[model samples]
Target: MKILHLFNELKFSGAEIMYVSAAPLFQKLGCKLTVANTSLQLGEYTPAFKTAGYTIIHQYIPHALLRQWKMRKELIQLIKEGGYDVVHIHRSDLRWIMSYCAWRTRCKAVYTTHSVFRSHWYSYPLHFMQRWTAYHLFHCTFQTISDSVDANERNYYHTQTTLIYNWYGSTRFYPATKEEKKQTRLELNIPQDALVIISVGGCSHIKRHHDVIKAMPTILKKYPKAIYLHLGEGNTLEEEKVLAKSLNLNQNVRFYGNQKDVRNFLIASDIYVMPSKFEGISLTTIEAMACNIPAILYNVPGLRDFNKEKECALLIPESTEVLAKSIIELYENPKQQSTLIQNGKEFVDAYFNMEKNARKIFELYTKR
Candidate 1:
């Protein structure tokens, strides 16, 4: 089968990561795969696909209204000429437009909702339009892939949706030995004895990185050796840095803009922290768990599914004081730390195994 995957941007987001990881699996199953990324700048993962012998087509679509319309015309032309059997779209904004274009060509169109809930003010209107377009355009056989049953229901309760757990390639992100961790710390100039808390994601308000910085003072009261590493980059980086400096944590907090190899930093860290205001499902959290790093995340919908209190991780309300307390409690109790780490590794290995997830996704595509 020939498959074409569509994404709004080729950035280092969860949806883009999923496509990059799953592309090789499609090749292994003897299917031809092609990626159509609307962004002009192909992200770090684009070369990986090229190396794996998959074709990636970059469709430059400006955010301007007139330019987007032109891009849609070009997208339709590409779909017609490509002769793909399945056209799968990963982002919602592309869904309605792509579905309409696919209808013109009479191709099978499938969409996957990477985010579970809509937090934006325009989400409800966009979702309503998506549902309408799905029913009118295409073959009226629109299907969605969601991370959890709750997520599936939250987005497409009345539509056809399947729950497929998000996965991390274990080979890419795994726990390091003591020696490996020490070497990584030395390379990054991180103190070996310091309590390292690494948070990997874009510096967005939804990620609540500011909240993590707010809790830093409290965490330092107990573990003065604590250091917070903010990985990845976005618009909020400057504002967050300012906030950290104002809180007198500029020296303790390090912002590593964006690293291609995040596993090295993950291995050097003692804990992973995410105080997201909302999440569809978090790939960073799963990656940290795969590395056997216990996580301290806010009690949000998708996060709550993984970090059950007293189980694999420590879940706290979206308060800096509560997050500080959880971090201190975990740091003070070694037995609890060991248990959380062990449980986290086991849970991730069983459920978020990339191989298993790849097979399931292939099955979904091949099913009649």
Candidate 2:
């Protein structure tokens, strides 16, 4: 089977990583996998994809509507020339174009909605318009890959969508040894005695870095040696840094912008906390769980689906007081912490294995 995967950017994100991880598995199963991205720069994960023996196609086009139309025309030509069995689109903008192009080219198209929430308010109108185009103009056969039933239900009811869970890649991100943790901590200038709290996501308001900062005073009161590490980058970094300085948490808080090896950082941390206001399925949570780091996340739709309180993770209400209390409680009880960590690993291994999920997707593609 020949498959063409479409993405807007080749950035080191969950969607990009998922495609890179799954493409090799597909290739091993006697399938041809080709990747196309809007950006010429394939970002951090390009080397891994190249090493896996997959072809990368860069489609340079501006985000403007006219440019997108021309790009769609070019993409349709490519699909026709390649005679691909399937076209799978990961990003929303690309999904729209692929929907139209595939319909015109008489090719099967599949869309995976990685994120349930739009990144901006403008995206609302754009997505709604795309939905209209997909359903009416293109007569597109749509499917959604979601981590939670809430996301599934929302898409199904709102747009008559099909749903699947985003798979967790294999056990590459395991717990680090004492020596490894010590070396990583030293590199980051984190004290060995400190109770390290790591949050990995683009630094944005939706991820709620502000909420985490607000909870810190209370958390620090209990665990005086607490440290917060923010991983990844976004437009909000400077503002967050200013907020940290204002809160007098400059020493306790550190922002490691866009590290290539986040698995190392996850291994070095004592706990993984995600205070995001919204999500589809959090890859960072799965990575942390795989690393045997206990997770403390908001009891929101996507997060709550993965983390059962006192089971795999500690699910707290979306409040600074509640989050702080949970952090302190977890810090106080080492036995509970260990149990959560073990449970997290077990949960991910059982439900989120990438190879298994990719096989399911392969089956879907082969369906008549």
Candidate 3:
């Protein structure tokens, strides 16, 4: 089968990361996979795909009306001439337009919603059009990253939307060895006695890296040697830095912007917290749990799907005190930490296997 994966940008976002991880699985199953990314610059994961021997198509599409029209024409031409069996969109924004183009060629189209809820002004209208007109344009089939997202889209599109959990690089992101953990901590300049709390993903307002920084003072009052590492860079990196400075957490809060490999950091950390405003089965949260690190996340959409209760993880409300208190409690209680480690790893290994979930996508593709 010939498949074209249309991504909005080439950044190492959750959806893009999933594509990078799942492309090999699809190829291993005898499907021809091509990644076409619409972004001004080549994405971080572009090289990874190229190194893995996959064809990557990068086209710069400007926001100007005329340039967008030109890009859309080119996209349609690529799908039509490439003779792709399916055109899958990783971002929801362009699904309507792509669906229309697919319709012109009579090609089957599929869309994956990287976000569970609509947040932007553009998304509000785009989502409305998708939910209402998908049958006519998008063929009414959708893929969501979580159960909550699947239900939300099913209620709106009333089509055959399915849940395909975001696959992680479990082989690389597994639990750290004793020597590996010590080396990573030493590399990061963390003392053996210090408590390291980490969060991996883009640093954005939606991700609420600021809230993690806000809760740092409280965490430090109890564990002064505690260091909060916010890995990954975004527009909000400076904003979070300013907030950290104002809160006098400059020493405690450390921002490592845009890391290509976060496995070492994940394995080295004592705790992983994803204090996001919202999510759709966060890749970082899964990666953390795969590393046997106790995760603390809010009872939000994405994280909730992972059985992120007290058994597997420390689920809490989106309060600074609540997050800090949860962290302190978990840090102080070794027994509870061990339970979370054991159960969270079990949950992740059982439910979030990348190969198994990638097969589900292939099944969705062939179902049509």
Candidate 4:
């Protein structure tokens, strides 16, 4: 079967990373996958997709209103000519156009909701119209990656969706040995005895990376050698860097932009921290848990879902003081940390296994 995965701008984000790790599993199910860059310009993570053994194609969809119709026509022609059986869309911006084109070409299309978003008052009318058109007219199906996303879609679109939980690369994201951890820290130029705190995923406003940075001063007071590893890059990266510098926390915070192997960083870290405003079940958080690192996530929609039992991770209020306190508390309490680690590892192993979830996605494709 031929499958085409569509993205607005391919980047080093959760959805992109999850697919890269799961693509081979899909291929194992006898599917040929093609990824299309629908934005005006290609993204930096394009090479990673190509490395995942996908045939890369460009179907530029301009943001201009007048140009979308022509681009939509070209996209329809491409889908038909490529003989794609499934067109899986991972972006929301131009989904209506993509779904319309996929339907016009008579291909089964599915849109995966990777995050829960709240529409503004003005966007409600357009959201309703476009969503109605996509679900009814285009016959496009929706798939949500988390319970929060599923609930949000049901509330907004009034539709039932395929709820497929997100997964991570279990083999690559497992715990590291003592020697491996020491060696990784040495290679990364981090002190062996220093406390390492990490937060992976794009540095976006909603990610609240700045919240973590703001908490660094308080954390530094407790553990002077505490180091913050900021992985992934986005619009708020420079602003975060400036914030760190302005507060004299630059020395403690290391901004290592997008990384290919974040597992090494996770393996080296003592605690995983993500103060995201929300998430669609963050792949990074699960990866950290799978790596046996206790997590401290903000009590938000997507992040809070991981704390259903309140045993796997420490879900605290979104406050700089609380975040700093939680990190210090987790670091000081090794027994508590160990409990979280064991429970988190088990939770991820039980639900976020790539092989299992990838098969579910493949079934969705084949069934259609």
Candidate 1, superposed: residue stretches over 4 Å from native = 40-45, 61-73, 119-126, 132-137, 140-157, 307-310
| Models ranked on TM-score | 4, 3, 1, 2
lDDT of 2 by residue, 188-271 (tens): 777888888889888788888888888888888877878998897876889988988999998888888888788878877888
Q: lDDT of each prediction vs. the true structure?
A: 0.78, 0.78, 0.79, 0.87
Candidate 3 clashes between residue pairs 3 or more apart in a chain or in different chains: 233-258, 281-302
Regions more than 4 Å wrong, model 2: 39-48, 61-72, 118-141, 147-160, 177-189, 308-310
Ranking by lDDT: 4, 3, 2, 1
lDDT (C-alpha) at residue 34 in model 1: 85
Candidate with top TM-score is 4
**Taking the tens digit of each residue's C-alpha lDDT, what string does model 3 give over 315-347?**
799898898888889988999899989988888
Query: RMSD for each model, in Å, please?
Result: 2.8, 3.2, 2.6, 1.5
Which stretches in model 3 have alpha-carbon errors above 4 Å? 61-72, 119-126, 136-140, 156-159, 308-310
- For every model shown, what is its TM-score relative to the native structure? 0.89, 0.86, 0.91, 0.96
Q: Write the per-residue lDDT of candidate 1 for residues 1-368, one digit (tens) a residue.
A: 88888776667777677667776777888779888777777766677666656689987656554465567777788888898777887766666677777777877777776665543665666566666767555643444333443445445545556667778887799889999999999998988899888899988988889988998998898778799999988779999999999999977899988787989989999889889876767888889988989888888767877854337878888898888888878877889888888998888887787878878777766765
Model 1: lDDT equals: 0.78
Clashes of each: 0, 0, 2, 0
